[model samples]
Target: MSFGAQVLGTLGGIVVATLGGTLVYGAIRLTVGLRLDQEDEYNGADLSIHKISATPERESLG
Candidate 1:
């Protein structure tokens, strides 16, 4: 009903959401893991998954 109450409610919602998301991701990391392996990390995600560089650069002055 008041501007101050609205702001406080929004801030509280954000804090709860952030903590909930962190807990979910932490559980997943502990069980399945979340990252690229050595070779994949070295090669980069685009080259590994899409078979192309994320940013292609032409070396010509045309």
Candidate 2:
């Protein structure tokens, strides 16, 4: 292959790899955020952190 062709091929490979990595990272971050939101909902983080309680009997430890 010519030198120009080799350089282009290398650049293309790099671009594709970078895009793939970005997509994977975004997916992982989204999944983690959703899971954290679910946990916060279940454990009542708002009550503990923000002093807002759905149940009046629950008190903020902070």
| Top of the candidates by lDDT | 1
lDDT by residue (tens digit), candidate 2, 1-62: 89999999999999999999999889998876524465566778766458677755645343
Candidates' C-alpha lDDT:
0.89, 0.77
Off by over 4 Å in 1: 40-62
- Clash pairs detected, candidate 2: none
Badly placed stretches (over 4 Å) of model 2 are 33-62
Give the per-residue lDDT of model 1 (tens digit) for 1-62: 99999999999999999999999999999997798789989989998878988775664333
Q: Give the TM-score (vs. native) of candidate 2.
A: 0.51
Error of 2 at 26 (Å): 0.3
lDDT of 1: 0.89
